[model samples]
Target: MNTSPRILVVEDDRTVRTVVNDYLSGQGFSVTAVDNGSEVLARFAAERPALVVLDRMLPGLSGDEVCRALRATSDVPIIMLTALDAVPDRIAGLESGADDYLAKPFALKELKLRIEALLRRSRQAGAAPSEFGLGPFRVDPARRHIRRDGVPIPLTTREYELFLYLLNNPGRTISRDEILREVWQWQFGDPSTVTVHIRRLREKIEEDPRFPVHLKTEWGSGYRFDLRGGEG
Candidate 1:
C-alpha cells in the first residue's frame, strides 16, 4: 500500500484540476483528481485521501453537500475552493465544515502551504496524556475523541486540535496569531478562520455560545479557554 498521503482533488475546471494535480503530485503527494462531487465519497473510500481539495461549485452533489457528507463520516481535512472571496461565502464554507478555504485566483504556493500545515497537524502523533477533562469534558488523544460527562462530543479535526491546544494551556489568553502559529501551524493566515472554528467549538462545549462559558473572547486580545468556565 502506498503510504504517501493521498489527496482527493474535486474540481470541475479542467485547467484548475490539472494544475492542482500536477503541482500537488510534484510536491510528493499521491493525488487523485475527480470532477463531480457525486463521486467524492466513492473516491474517498477507495483513495483514502488524507485531505480533500473541494471546489465550492460542483456538477452533481455540490461542494457544500459533499463537505457535509464527509464531515458526517470522517474528520479528514478539507480545503474549499471558492470563486468568490467574499467574507460571507468563506464563512458559509467553514460553517459547512470545511477545515480550510482558498479563494479562486489564489497562489498555488499558498495552497501548498495550507495543505502542508493542515497535514502536519493531522499527522501529529497521538501520544498525548492518557486522559484530560475540564469539568464534564475529557479527551483521549489515542482514541481521537472528546467527551462531556462520559458522552462523546463529535468534533472535526481542526476543532479537536484547537480544543487540545486550549486544554494544554489553561487560563492564558491565546491570541489568534498565536493560535494560527501553534495549532494551524500557519505563519500567516486569515484570523476569521480561527474565529469561526472557535465559535463552532464553543457551540459544542458551552452552555450558551452567545454567552460562552468555556471559550471566552478577550475583547480585542483574541480568546481564552477558561477551565472554570468563569464560574469562580
Candidate 2:
C-alpha cells in the first residue's frame, strides 16, 4: 500500500528536470518526469498524477495550451514553471487555468511547499460537504462542480475553492492576505494569483463582472461575497 502522492513533472530542461526529480523523490513523492509538452497529455493520462509541474515554455504544445486543455475536462492542480517573471505573464498563466505559478530559478523547497498546500486543500475540500446551495449557485464539493441558475460554470480548482470560501463567509470582508492564507494555504506568495482567480471567478458568477454584485472589493481591504445578492 503506497501512500506517497504521484506527481508528473513536465519540463524540457534536463538539469532542472533531474534536480527536481531527485529533490521531490527525496521528499517522498512518486514522480513521473517527461521532457516535452507533446508527451504531456499522453503521460498524464497514463500516470494520472495527483498534481502536475508544468513548464510554461515548451516546444510542442506550450504550457498554456496544455493548461487550457486540462482545464476543459480535468480539475487537476497545475503549477506552471516559467522564465517570464513579469506580472502580466504570471496573470496570463493564472488565467490560463494553472492553480499556481513558479518562475524559473525558483527554490525547490518552495515548490514542494506549494505542492503540499494545493494537495492538502484539495483533500480537505473533497472530504465533506457533498452539496452546498449558495444563493443561486450550487456547489458540489464531492464532484468539485459549481452551477449557477442551473447552468454549469466551469471553474478551475483554485477558483472553485475561492468561491466556496467566500460563499461560506458571505457578507464578511476578507482581506487579500487572509485569502492567501486560508484559501491558498500560503504564508507568503505573489498574491497576484488571488487577484487573477477572483477576476476569473467574477466572470463566471457575476451578472456584470465590471460592477460585480456578489463578489465586491472593499477598496482598501479585500473582497466580500454577498451571497444574498439581488436582495435586500
Instruction: For residues 33-134, write the lDDT of model 1, one tens digit per residue.
Output: 999998999989977888999999999898999999999889899999999888888988998899889999889999998898888777664655577676
Clashing residue pairs in candidate 2 are: none
Model 2, 49-95: lDDT tens per residue? 89999999888899899988888778899999999999999999888
After aligning candidate 2 to the native by TM-score, how far in Å is the CA of 41 from where it should be?
A: 1.0
lDDT of 2 at 66: 91
Best by lDDT: 2
TM-score versus the correct structure, for each prediction: 0.90, 0.90
Evaluated at residue 178, the lDDT of candidate 1 is 98
Estimate the lDDT of model 1: 0.88
